[model samples]
Target: MVSIGLKGLRHLDQKPTLSKANRNSFTNEYWKGVRVKFIIQAAAGGISFMLLFLACSCYLYGSLYKSHQRYHNFRILAVDYDGGVIGKALSAAYEELKRPEFPTLYFHSPEDFPTPSDVYQIVRNGHYWGAIYSTKGASDRLEAGIQGGQAATVYNPNDALYWVWNQQYYTTFAQSVVEASIEQLVSAARAAYTKINGTQAFPYVAQSDPDAVQAFLNPIAATVANVEVDAQDSVFLFTSISMVMPVLQQFFFLLALNGVSREHQLYSKMSVRSSMIIRGVAGLLYTFGAALTQAGYYWAFRDGWKVDGNQFVLTWMVLWLLMHTHFTYLDAISAITPISRMPFAVLTWIFLNISTTISPLELQPGFYYWGICLPASNAYSVLVTIWSGGGDNRLYRALPIMFAWWIVGNLLSMAAHLRACHLAYKFDKEQQNNKGDGESAMGMTPVGSEVTIRPHSTNESAAHDDLQQDKTLEEQDLEQRQIYGPSIPPPFA
Candidate 1:
């Protein structure tokens, strides 16, 4: 009852209308200095921070995984079971496999057989992805039925151990050698049969019956003709850069907004002030634009690194516009919480933690899509298109989805920011009156008046001001005590 009565009397303590107008004029004068200072400070700090981030990013990505490249030469060991003739044939076949650039090859005679377990262990420990083993069972089968015998047996490590690049060529070369051997044996058998009979022997069917030949050859031909590997090498790097760049950019926006929310907390009436609103929006846009420009420049100059530059640029622009707008909306949510900074900081950290999988757009789609929906996901998509030779069609298809997400996220954020701003200001006069004073006729410094408005930035004075609001309340107490006989009684007490 006493607090309510005091609150009722507090409004009667407001400054008269004429003095209020004069104070307004003074406040305008005070803020001209404030605006000029803030504009300079914000512009300087924003540019400095952006450049530093860009420089660091460029240094990190410029080499593009050069450290993992394998330059040391290595050798492959081959074991031959056949005598000199078969051995020579095997050697020729091995050499053929090694052609177009041999790493190194060492041939071992058949008698020096390593046990199967030892062979497996050696291959595993030897850093060798390839090895071939022949067995006597294959030779005996061939001798028993020269024209219809099983081909020589060769054992290899698990398919996972196969060298990705050499798998197809190696298979083709091995089949060709088997066919040549079969043909030689069959020809010798036909000659021997004719020599014994003194004329031609009964006709034997060929392995290349037309129907069988077509069934085997047709699909293989189509597969080779239709399957394409039209990938550029730099797609991986470009996608990587894209995935990480958005995360860095969003982090800057989140932190900067946290600072803005702090400023609003410092002065209550400033929430509804049009100037504050404009500056808040403008500052956010400026930072967002700066980050976007840096990302775009990196994208454009990426050179033959990625294709579809213009498409990527368009997609990215629409996507970021949505993202920054959504961030503006989220500003309110951050401000209303007791510790607004913590949520944004933690969320940004979480997004970054999950962003690694999509860090490069050029990765195979199977891997890229796994974690691509994270903040870096869209950026990775745009980058992959550029790196993998996509263009306008892909951008047109993708940007709408990104734009929709951006819109939805911003809408939620904006609603929260606006409501929080309103609530923060609503308690301004109440909080002020609750201090050691009844209330000033002027009401919490009328925001811009008497308040030394700095640039909407956090500097030493601002930090000090944050902890120093009691001085403003002190002045109000002195004025109230002089006029009202000190009945104010420390409003809380």
Candidate 2:
């Protein structure tokens, strides 16, 4: 049945010319074209690009946090009453917090007693995230678990748990350090108290009396309340901004390959006048269209995505349009000198394949040229700057580079158009010249008069020959005149 149907269809159908097939194929072709353009744009700077951007941002965010933590972690300032053993123990505890694994710990020794005001000033200056001040006998009090006795005082500049915990840990660790340091002093004090008053030996473990510890540590540990400090995500913002390079590169590649190439091929045969106007209009329309599409989707899903919709939308739109403009200009050029297409295509692919740095400019400084020269590189940098938010500085700084590509592209397009036109003119002239030569060669001149002359004859024989030739010419001219009217002159006349 299938074979029968196929035979019937084939028999019924008459094959059409290639031109007709093209016209029939236009509808699907247009949609396919649009899809290709979209794909290129998306691939250049689309979801994958965004994901890469996000990944870089996330990576940079983590890095920034590490840097921030390096400077602003936990801090400790201790004053001890028992010689300096208690202070040494507190310092040792603070030193333990300084290891890289520790989140945020800073230790400081103040000439004057550490105060809430001092911590506030430091935190306000954005130096320290949290601060801690330790008092002497604070450890002894912790052992007792008692309420109101002389408690080793801990002052928190920033209400960070690390400091509070540090005060606790400091007390524990310091108590151990102090216990080891002042074993002789403590032993002497206990033995003196026992021998002088006739009491028993000091207990195996050090005494853990809160009130007693407080009394002993008090003057040394100034009474200060907790001061809460808020930390800003400066690092996250910075990291996020740094990831824009990848996004820009992705976008540029899409624009150059899909959008530019497609448009160029489509309008390849259009009149120069129409082509220029249509190209400009189409570029503007598509750019705005792309921007609006992205803006609308982003606005709807911004919150869920944890990005600033309004800013993101605006940036996305601007970057999208900029990329479209770049692509359109490139298309114009590609249309003119299609010979350059292969090179342009290869370079575009390379740019897309290259990995963008987290802070490309900041890291290498030299890569700026490579990033700026290529369409994908420029687009990636622009997108990263726009999407990430922090690199507005870098973006603005890099503006000239981006602008340069656009200008150069537009110039190339103009040059290509001129070149195409010049080539076309030369071709037309050559054709016209060839046609004229062919026409001149095919045209005829009369056979006898000026074109072919009878030679002068001497004697009676030559006269007879001349008369015969003249008679022939007369006959031929008569026939020519009869057929073509009086246009041929009569030889006899």
Candidate 3:
């Protein structure tokens, strides 16, 4: 008997248990919910996430990759005024040596070539990366120096000028490439001249000697001098941190907004004034918490904690204020409009992708350049200034913008709350009037006591009978309560 019982127990264990079956059934039902409308929403959310991910990734990786690949097909404006043999030879060598893997020289010598100031303006406007100018008698000077044996006096009035923008990655890279190209061309031209004239030109030494050859090859080197207009070197960590700043802001803003919205819904039955106050307080707390959390992140990963203490504190405060304002703005939007959280989330993502830190703001086109005035952009500017030790001058310039956003958002939110309060009061008053009417019609006192009344005339009695036949005021009030009670307002009004 014991053996048989054990065999039965083993068989029962091998079979699917009731709990397991129930869990399986529950999972199936849960999965079944992901159909039709659920699928549409899920698909939309998935697409939005993908787009946001791609935009951010493109901005970060695309900028870096473009900087790396900028040497390929890099365009440099060349204004050649030396229409001589040496100048032609050097220009031809530059063009021939230009490769797909290296920068290509585009020589432009229009009849009316742009003046130096024009070239400066063109570069400043980002029309070209840099410009090379060869003076009118460059080749004449070179040939005369070679034939006259005036090696020390042999100089080409050719120069490379680069426009220095706020972001120096592309400018610096282009400058280096162009400078190297100019040196190579000079060496090639000198070699050709030596072969034709049977004498060294620049170094005034025989090409057979190694030191002499080196000197001849590098007779004159190009020096890059930047015209600084608030330009700074592109630090990888700083750029990366700036790109990440907007993401943190968007996340915390949405988080706080969603939390406040939910809190408001839960306490919606309370007076509007109380609800607004509670939401405002919740927003402040969440902003503070998020700021602290971000500060920790910056300290641990960005080395912000170990760096300048005052700057870090200032950055934290700015971030806190910005987040608070952003959350308040979203709350106000929700209160006044029928727009949902998804749209706001998408807008935040847009701001993150378009901010100046991810890509050079100056390089962007018109609409994108305008995006620099956004709150995220302002915050990025402040953080970058603090990080770069640009002092309080730059930081102060951005503070006013942040403050403005805060004030505007708070005012709009307050207005929404006041409007809600007014509506609620009106609704409550209407309900009270309906209740009073119901009591009068039922001949009952407000205390729920029965009241007796005498009929005045036949016409009055008939009207009263008709009123009794109609739906009672209590029923109407009950219906109104049913319609309005336990209802959470839509995200959009």
My TM-score estimates for the predictions, one after another, are: 0.37, 0.38, 0.49
Model 2 ranges off by over 4 Å:
1-275, 294-303, 306-309, 332-354, 357-392, 429-493
Ranking by TM-score: 3, 2, 1
What lDDT tens digits, residue by residue, belong to model 2 across residues 1-493? Answer: 2234565565543434323544544356557757777778767756655665566445434433433223212333333332233334444544443443343334454544345455545532323323444443443433332223333234221111112211111122222332232222223332332343222212322246544333333212223332321122232322233233333433344344334423333223446667556655655566666656545544554442334656666566655645564554545534442332334443443333243323232222233335445444455445444443433234554467667766776676656555544444454465456555443333323456355333433244544544443335465433322211112122333
Expressed as tens digits, the lDDT of each residue in 182-228 for candidate 1 is: 23322332333234321211232123344322221211100011011
Q: How many residue pairs clash in all the candidates, one count each?
A: 14, 21, 2
Which candidate, 2 or 3, has the higher lDDT? 3
Q: What is the lDDT of residue 240 in candidate 3?
A: 47
Q: For model 1, what is the C-alpha lDDT against the true structure? A: 0.40
- Candidate with top TM-score is 3
Per-residue lDDT tens digits for candidate 3, residues 1-493, read: 2244665775753454523644554246666765566779989988977787776666545444534344544555666665655445556556566665455556776465556556544544445555555555555554443333443244432331222222233334434564555556555554544454334354554444444444344433233433322233433444445445534564445444444344343333576667667767877887787777776666656431225678668777877876777666665654554333445454555455445555555334344555556676677667655553552234455678878888998999788667655555565566667666655655556565665664657446655765665567676544333222212333444
Q: Which of the numbered candidates is closest to the native, going by highest lDDT? A: 3
Q: Pairing residues by index, what is the TM-score of model 2?
A: 0.38
- Which candidate would rank higher by TM-score, 1 or 3? 3
